[model samples]
Target chain A: MKVVALAGGVGGAKMADGLARVLPAEDLTIIVNTGDDFNHFGLRICPDLDTVCYTLAGLANSLTGWGRSEETWNALDSIRRLGGPDWFQLGDKDLGTHLERTRRLSQGEPLSKIVRDFSHSWGIAPLVLPMSDQPVETWVETQEMGWLPFQEYFVAQQCQPRVKKFAFKGVEQSLPAPGVLDALEQADCLVICPSNPWVSIAPILNVPGIKESCEGICVRVAVSPIVGGKAIKGPAAKMYEELGIAPSVLAVAESYRGLIDGLVIDAVDNSCRDELEAMGIHVLVTKTVMQDYIDRMNLAKETLEFCQKLMLYKGRQ
Target chain B: MKVVALAGGVGGAKMADGLARVLPAEDLTIIVNTGDDFNHFGLRICPDLDTVCYTLAGLANSLTGWGRSEETWNALDSIRRLGGPDWFQLGDKDLGTHLERTRRLSQGEPLSKIVRDFSHSWGIAPLVLPMSDQPVETWVETQEMGWLPFQEYFVAQQCQPRVKKFAFKGVEQSLPAPGVLDALEQADCLVICPSNPWVSIAPILNVPGIKESCEGICVRVAVSPIVGGKAIKGPAAKMYEELGIAPSVLAVAESYRGLIDGLVIDAVDNSCRDELEAMGIHVLVTKTVMQDYIDRMNLAKETLEFCQKLMLYKGRQ
Candidate 1:
């Protein structure tokens, strides 16, 4: 069965990794958010895409859930001492991606082509696509800074930007890249890979024509990033609470009401299953903590079975 | 006694180093060639300027006459693994300059300010300014590549191209940076360091208003990059031969004939004193080979004394 997953950084990468492990390489297509891409020291840093790419290539630092394992920071430290902004951490080995990507982009190569070529170089098999070809930066509308780039708000500010809301700059101008529509069109299922609802998935859905494409054919499903008012990683839980949401699965379901067919939450948050089901959304509760390879595969198996059974029930009816 | 020294790379850096040791920090201003600057791995690299800066900071590699003394190439090797072009040999420590300069430039800081900041950061007190504010890339019109950027032609292509001529792209648009004119105007003596006559000094002179600003000012002099029909360091002699020059001090002198007031040669090439004198140029013969600290200081003393003699002669006339 063909499957398309939209993802952001570490947490989404982990889920994407789970899907890649469970499904055939030909069946899985991952669409990464490129909103964090920015030129720093002339290097084009694509944080989310790199997280997914490295995770798939087994090059990611599993402990940190970002950058390459065994990476050095000699370059970064030297750069810092030279008085460049050291807020956003770039590992030395990981810097190769930014360097090559920046160079290629400066030479008129598109981000899509660079990512595809880089994925090929890294020996990643599954199809990986950027959400949009044009710039669609996720800007945080903070009370202090007024508007901060997603990384500056999320990373540099350490998510301390009392975020009132988010603004996806250039989203109106962005279009879903070529393979994204095709991937959704051909897929048996569209999975929003447990990424941040407002920032990650919203940016993907914000792309013009993408929502229509996802709504047309695919059995769209979402794995809830929130379980028991907690995120698996990153600032999602804090962001949800700061945005006046209770940081719960029900809040996530509300956030993605029209977009998803099934909502996958952890067994720990099983109490909210009926509440979500009451809202006419199919709910699947399982061990969603991807602590090990087995956890990923098991969760992937359960989700696939849930989608398969739901489709079968609909077919019979 | 303010001084402005025009320089290229290694040989220029050596002379600049000698002068830097002898002169007061604020008195000596070294204007280095940015013609050798190139974008590698998305970072702006100023090769000639970096060589001068590192040498003056006492951080220069003794063997290579360029780059940082204690250096590591782990980043370059890592970049190679990531399938990047590591051909230009970017060391970890040297990356500090590129990163800082790039960061500052991206923030709309001028190259002159960045160079001064970099010099101060590295504990080099004397001023070092790029020859121009705007980029004036040196392109070698080669028989093979037609025209290649200076670094590509020099480092990547290994200078294999049959030299036709040179082009200083964007030179017409370039302006001599802030301190350049003032340094030239206020100087008691001007020393043209033993950098490449064609590639280095030519680029400096090619800057708009720089040549006119320095002409007929104080005691303008140059040290020999060529002695016994050979360059002390780098491809000056080879480049001279390829460009159809005889690779002698006379050819070197002829290149700078209109721009300089006096010439300095080693005692070894003293036989050609009459030839240089025939051109109506004052010549100084000295032990120019800077084998150690004493040799460098002695050469600096000779250059200074030569400048004094030129001023005295001019007074007599």
Candidate 2:
């Protein structure tokens, strides 16, 4: 089946990688969130786009799930020695992406075009598209820090600030990048990978026409980022708790509510399936924590199969 | 005596390092050529300023006479892998300097202030300053390439292009950086380090009032970059030949003309001393090719002593 996956960073990149593994190159397109994109040390840095690209190209550090495998930090270490900011943890190999991207961007090339060219250079088969050509920064409103830019909240502050809400600046004006609408139109199913609902998927969905396009798809399934009352990674669960909502599979499903035709929950959250089905959403309980390449592939396989079942069920209805 | 040195890249930096070794930190100030500075892969790279700073800080690669001593090439290597330009050969540690400088420049910090802060951070004792806070890019007019930026001519093309002339784009309008004029005003003598006359020392002198300010000083001595009719390092001799002048101490002396009171030439070119003296300029023959720390110190000492003798002669005259 033709699949288009919406992704953020690590978890989303893992899910996208899983789909890339199982599907033909021509049949898969991954739309990555660019809301987390920021300029670090005067270089354009797109965290989620790079993560998805690196993961798909098989260059990602398996242990960290971000940055390149065997990456060096001579540049960052040197910057630190010179008393420059070192909070971002830029890797030498990963910095190449930012440097080249910044150069091209300054030369007036769009981010999407740079990502496309880089993917081709890295020998990546699957198409990786950023959510928008225009920037949409994710600003987080926190209890102590007020409003912090995404990277400061996520990386520098280590996500310790109590979350209030997220504002995706520029999302209202951002159009889906070239091929994004076409990919959604051609896809048999849209997979919302297990990324943070607020910062990651929200920014992509909030783009002017993206949600409407996804709504037109026959099958739309979301893999829960939260499992067993905590995020498999990142601050997704903590963000949920701070925003006055219980962090659970049901909360995740409810967040996607009318847009998603099916929800893929972890086995640990299987108890919420009956309630989710009662609310008119089809539910699939499976192992959602992707520990390795094999786990990613298996979960991807199950998610796609669930999409097929949901599409058939909708047709019968 | 308080000494101010005009410098460019390797040769100049070596001379500055030698001066730094012998003089107390408070006694020396090095004004570096920023004409060779350019934006590489979106980073503001200052070749001469960095070379002087690195040499003074004891971080320069002794073998290459540029870059960090224990530099890593992961960033540049990775950029090459992605089909990005590798012509500039930016080392990882070197990139940190560019990155931070670029960041600070973007934040509206003056280049001189940033250099001062960086010099202090690197434990460099002597004051290091760029010729101008405003950019003064050296564009080389070549027979083959028409016009190429300084680094493009020097590093990227390996200086093979036949030089016709040079244009310091902003030099006519640029003022000497904050401390540059004050440094010259306070100096007992100004020593033009053994760097390229066309691109290096000329650019610094071209900064509107800099040469005029030096004219007010009692002693102004320049060390010839040529020895045995060849440059000790870099494209100085080749450039002199291309510009229709035989590469010799006499040609170098003529290039400086009335601006300098004395010329320090290599012992191999002592034959030209009388001819240079005929032009009303005193000449000192010494071992001007600095190969190591001792060579740099000895050359610096000789250049300063030559200035003292010229000052004494001027007093008697």
For candidate 2, the TM-score of chain A alone versus the native chain A is: 0.99
Model 1 clash pairs are none
Best by lDDT: 2
State TM-scores per candidate: 0.91, 0.97
lDDT of 2 at A307: 90
**Residues A1-317, candidate 1, lDDT per residue (tens digit)?**
88888899887898888888889899999999888777667777888999999999999998998998988776777777667778878776777677777777878877888788888888888999999878888898987889998888878888887789888899898888878898888988888888888888888888988888888754778899987789988788898888887899999999988888789999889999899999888988988778877877787788888888778866787
**Two-chain DockQ for each candidate model:** 0.47, 0.76
TM-score, cand. 1: 0.91
lDDT of 1: 0.85
Please identify model 2 stretches exceeding 4 Å from their true place: none
Per-residue alpha-carbon lDDT of candidate 2 for residues B1-317, written as tens digits (9 for 90 to 100): 88999999999999999888888889999999999999888789998999999999999999999899998898887788878898987998898889999999999999999999999999999999999999999999999999998888888899999999999998889989999999999998888888999999999999998998888878888888899999978999999889999999888889888878888888899889889989988888888888888998898777777777877888898
User: lDDT of candidate 2 vs native?
Assistant: 0.91
List model 1 lDDT by residue over B1-317, tens digit each. 67888999988888888898898988998999989988776688889988998888888998898888878776677567667787888887777668878878878989998888777777898889999879999988888789888888889888888788889999999999998998888888889998887788888999998898879477889999998889888778988898887898898789888777899998889988999999988899888887776777888878988898888998898
